[model samples]
Target: MKILIVSQFYYPENFVIYKIAETLQKFGHDVHVLTGRPNYGYGYILPEYKKIKEEEINGVRVHRVDLPARKRGRLSIIFNYLGFWYNSRKWVRKTKLKFDVVYSFQLSPVTILSAGNLYKKKHHVKHICHCVDLWPESVLVTNAVRKKSLTYKILYSWSKKLYRACDEILIGSPSYKEYFATTLQIMDKNIVFVPQPSLVENSRKIKTQNLGEGFNILYCGNIGTIQMIEMIPEAMKLVKNSLVKFHIIGMGPMSKKLVNKITELKLEDKVIYHGPLPSPKAAPYFKGANALFVSLKNEGIVGKTIPNKLVMSMAFTKPILAMLEGDGKRILTESKGGIFARQDVKFLARAIEKIAATPTSELKKLGELNQIYYAKHFSLETITRKIEKHLR
Candidate 1:
């Protein structure tokens, strides 16, 4: 099968598409990516990639189109999206190549899937829309837009059209199935629950580092509004254990605010903020930590979402300290991986203390259980095979 993956973010930008494309190629499918030049995180295109370029990554083809260079701001982000949407639409219309199937990695600005839907109709092929974030609802919860606004209504209507056009819809969490079925009136038969695959390589060994003497709890990935990172410092103030250290290993819009809160709370000694690190560089922090942290703001929309960091932590055999409800908490409870706390300072403090008081042997056993569960459910091979079944 010749498959074309349409995604706004791809290789060299730290997304699952890189590994998914590689896995499809390994399974004897001809995989190609239709993506924009590397511009995420850095907010500018890389030096090597030209406005339009084609490259082969591990036998899979990648076609990158030009994207507008912009800083991190509302207007800048909108311009960037417009640039990709326009360029990708033009390229798709002009290209003579055909695909057996089209896969859309729906992240944000769901309009990107329009290009894939177009190609699916033109080529008469199967189209699969894999939604990582629920639109309109996510935007509303993050206060990006008001539910009564015209923009919000437009987004909602556009998303419904996209959902209806696809041959199959793959949601990252079971909770999302309920959202689409109940709210959007989409049929449950067309929606499949397929969680995101772990990025951690099975054979890769972490060069563990000595992270001093204490219960090091690591929180990785994006530190954004949805993360509710300020709660970490607030909870730290309530924790009595002086040795329980909170290590944050990422950067985002809330980075400065989190740093300020740490200082204000006089938690400078208890919390350490290590700026963003590449996935490989971040491994030691995960491996060295006694437990990993995952949280989201207590909102109805947030409950339906699962952070990719949680799945990666499980692959590393790190017990999770989750302050999340719904699908995320369900994963932790079902795997017997770690303890959960309500999204409150007191409960979070108690949860941390519980982990701190537990014996190292018991923590190791919990981590081992998480590892076994990850292998059975969230491993790359397992997820890839599940997706393959749908592709057939």
Candidate 2:
């Protein structure tokens, strides 16, 4: 099958779609990506992508469309969203590439799937939406608009229409099903729960680096607001074990504030910041750690999310220290793979303390349990097979 995967963000933006495309291509499908220029977290488009257009990445081919940089402000974000929606439509219409199916890697804006929907409608092909985010519900989480507001009402209606047009919808988390059935009034759609596969490539031998012995706890991914990185220093303050150390392996908007909190809490010696490193490069740190920390805010729709970081941690055989609620916490509990906390600073401190006190062999056993569960549910091979079945 010649499949075209449409997404607003791809490649350098750190989206799972990049992995999906590559995997699909490796599965003997001609996979192509229609995505906006690489400009996500950094706000501005990277210099290398400025004028470059269509090209082959690995074996999968990629098509590009330009969009406004989602710089700092709310207005800029709106422009970026609308820009992709508008430009993707133009690109789809002009491209001569015909595909057997259209896979929509939907995230953030529900309309990111619009290009796939458009192509599906025009070519009379199948459109499979991989929905990772809910629209109006997301607005509630961000406080972007009130439920009764005109903006929310409009997005709510539009989201329903777009989703209904799809042949099937894939939910990244099982918690999303209720939202689809209730809020979107989409009970009849072929909505299947497909967990986000670990973006970490665990195929290669993990070369563990020494993270300075005394019980190193690892965290990888964005150090942004929702990540609850600020609680680390606060939690460490309560933790009785002085030998336990934290190693954060990513950077984001909250970097400065997180640093200030670390200093204020006088945890300079306990917390180690490695700025940001690529996933493969950061694997050693993940492999070397005594435990992996997964934290998220315990508020509204966001809490219901099964973060990629949580699944990614399970890819490596490491005992997890999960601090969140809903789907992610449920996964940890169900697998009996790691210790859980309910987004409380004191609880987080206690979880860390527990890991510090546990024997290294016990921690490795917990990691093996996580790996067993991940193999059954969240592994790339498991997910790709599910996707390929649908694509066929």
Candidate 3:
């Protein structure tokens, strides 16, 4: 099968689309990627990727479209989205190559999938939209736009059209099925639950890092408002044990605020910020940790979502210390992977203390169970096969 992946973010940006494309290629499918140039994180186009509009990397042919450099303001964001959307639509219309299936990675903004939708309509091919984030609801929760505003109404109507236009929809969270069915009036059978696959290989082992003699808890992902990473430092202050250390390894908008909070609380030693590390370098920190931490803000939309870090943490076989609810909590509880608490400083502190008191042997058993569950449900091979069946 010849598959074309339409995503705003892709390889060299450290997204799961790279893994999915590679796995598809390994499964004897011809995979092609259409994505924006590397301008994630700081938004500056990397030196190596500059001046090139298209290139082949690792046997996969990549078609890149120019996009505005990302910035913090709303104007900058809109420019980036509009630039990619316009260029990608133009490219898709002009390109002569045909595909058996058009897979759209609808991460956020949801408008990025418009190019794939056009192609699917023109070719009458199977179109699968993998929704990593729920739109309009996410925007509303983040206060990006008000629900009653005209902009929100337009976006809501646009989202409904996009979902209905697709031949099938792959939702990252199981909870989204009901939401789409009731809210968007989409059929439940057309919406399938396909959790994000873990990028780390189960066979890859990292040497544990020695960071003093304490129970190391690691949180390694985006440190943004949605992540609710501030809970870590606040919870650390309430923890009674002196040996528990929290290591945060990611960068986002809240990075400065988190740093200031750490200093304000005088938790320099108890809580350490390692900035952002590449996946290879970040693996050892996760491997060495006694437990992995994940959190989502107390928002209704956030509860129904599962962050990719949760699945990645399970791949390491480390007991999770999640401050989340809904699908995330359900996955943790069903896997017996680790303990969870609501988004409260006191509850998180108590949950940490409970994990601290549990015997290392018991924690090991929990980690093992998490690995078993992850292999069965969230492994790349399993997920790729499931996606393949749908593509065919």
Candidate closest to the true structure, highest TM-score: 1
What's the true lDDT of residue 271 in model 2? 90
Ranking by TM-score: 1, 3, 2
CA lDDT of each prediction against the hidden true structure: 0.86, 0.86, 0.86
As for TM-score, the candidate ahead, 2 or 3, is 3
lDDT of candidate 3 at residue 187, scale 0 to 100: 82
Summed backbone clashes in each candidate are 0, 0, 0
162-257 per-residue lDDT for model 2 (tens digits): 999999999888888988887778899888988778877563487887998698999888887778898898888898887999989888778999
Report RMSD (Å) for each prediction in the order shown: 1.5, 2.1, 1.7
- Which parts of model 3 have CA positions greater than 4 angstroms off? none
Give the lowest summed-lDDT range of ten residues in model 2: 195-204
Flag the better candidate by TM-score, 1 or 2: 1
lDDT of 3: 0.86
Of the two candidates 1 and 3, the one with more favorable TM-score, higher being better, is 1
Give the per-residue lDDT of model 3 (tens digit) for 317-357: 98999887888888888999889877788998999998988
Residue pairs that clash (backbone atoms under 3 angstroms), model 2: none
Query: How far is 144's C-alpha from truth in model 3 (Å)?
Result: 1.7
Q: What residue runs in model 1 are displaced by over 4 Å at the alpha carbon? A: none
lDDT of 2 at 188: 91
